[model samples]
Target: MKLAALVIAAACLLAPPSLAAPWLRTRGLGRVINGTATDIADFPWMASMQILDNSGCGASVISSTWALTAAHCVLASQEMPGAYTTLRVGSSSRASGGVRLDVAQMIKHADFHMSTDDADNDIGVIQASEPFPLGSSVQVVNLPGDGYDAPAGLPVTISGWGATATEFNPVYLQRADMHVLDRDTCRDMMADVATVTLGMVCAGDPTMAICYGDSGSPLVYGDMQIGIASWTRPGCISTTSVYTSVGNFRAWIRDNTGV
Candidate 1:
């Protein structure tokens, strides 16, 4: 019965053409439900991207010169080359307290599409205008080594400063604990809505999810980042969310940014 409910919700995720998708397409759409508020002391690689046309999204610092995010996020800004003007580093609060730096270049996967109603490459990169000053509060995250896939049932953590609901946006960052869902299982459940791809991963808890401004956020296991927040059901119907798999894009990342 519970699974049946999820399928029904998934089918209607993009029911009407008016549905805002790619998970939190507008500024007011993002938030973390059932998450604990935290600070920069923990997620040193966290980045808050500020885009002009929409509520900004989250990102992960992969190298001093580059950060990784969802390509759709860049597309939302309606700009090419460099989309957003600045990004916040080592900050937990979205509105204050962080070293604001310029964005040098914005790169998105060429094959990515804005809708998750089907297959989506869904990954992109942000190059800082200058090198980030690495320290206790600002550091690059460890990338997945070689070809690695997170096994099903593996616990993961995701953090962001989005919104809790349409009526609530959090000032501080939030983190939630979840686990990887089996690829086959995820595909089965999401088939009615999205076409889960090899380059994507699915994860969530019955009570945990990323929303509105949470796109481009990182999904990590220990110090290794495995996924990038991409999409979820509309209206925040389910905690289950789809992510861009970092493991599947190693060659692409190396080619684009040499990270």
Candidate 2:
């Protein structure tokens, strides 16, 4: 009965939408990650996960009615369900001006265990109450397919409404460019902190890393989303930060969302 109940709950989350269809009509040249503020259209897939009208984590639209985010972002709300109330998409500013959608369901990874030191399988999918309007400022991002791998030293973009400085939250979206680090290097960097598992990807620059509120943000390479911001060193100023490997969980995502 317990297994049956868990299976029934997982079934309710459904699969994500297909990404073969293009949703974005325009692309901005401005780079994200450790950069300046971005226009709403700059990263159309970007979504803001909010609780009580305040932005708490970042997400990406996978379809009109589905989104991808960090499992930990919705962990607290899993039991209460009502804790997470809204998802704001198609906006660069977190404070205002976006299409707000009610969160109907949140599906976290079954293997996810927050108390574990590694934070393995930290991905989640969210179903919105309605489809997001497709336009120049709103769209879905492509996920990395099977066998797709991000080689170390590869540059990728990270975007979110996270704090620009310690304890300094920003109203506008910010982005920065970071390079993928090899597993060995990542393990070394995080040796004193959390365990860097194969299920996670590591990226960051010497001067920049994902800070508070950046959790669940996308790490993009070309047009494909490669990772989701999972955790950072205590100060968020570490030379490296870990991300939940989207490629590693692509099959799981497809199994859950069918996309």
**How does each model score on TM-score?**
0.86, 0.84
Weakest ten-residue segment in model 1 by summed lDDT: 1-10
lDDT digits (tens) for residues 1-259 of candidate 2: 0000000111112111231101100111111234567787879999988765677678899887889988867764564344545899877888788789999898999987655254688899988998898899999899988746689999998888765542244678887887999989898877766788888898888766776667788889976899998776544547777888999999988888878
Q: Per-residue error at 135 for model 1, in Å?
A: 0.3
* Collision count of model 2: 8
Predicted model with the maximum lDDT: 1
- Candidate 1 lDDT, tens digit per residue, 149-174? 77899999888765574324456787
- Report lDDT (Cα) of residue 80, candidate 2: 36
Clashes of 1: 6
Task: State candidate 1's TM-score.
Answer: 0.86
- The residue pairs that clash in candidate 1, if any, are 29-212, 30-163, 30-211, 30-212, 30-213, 31-163
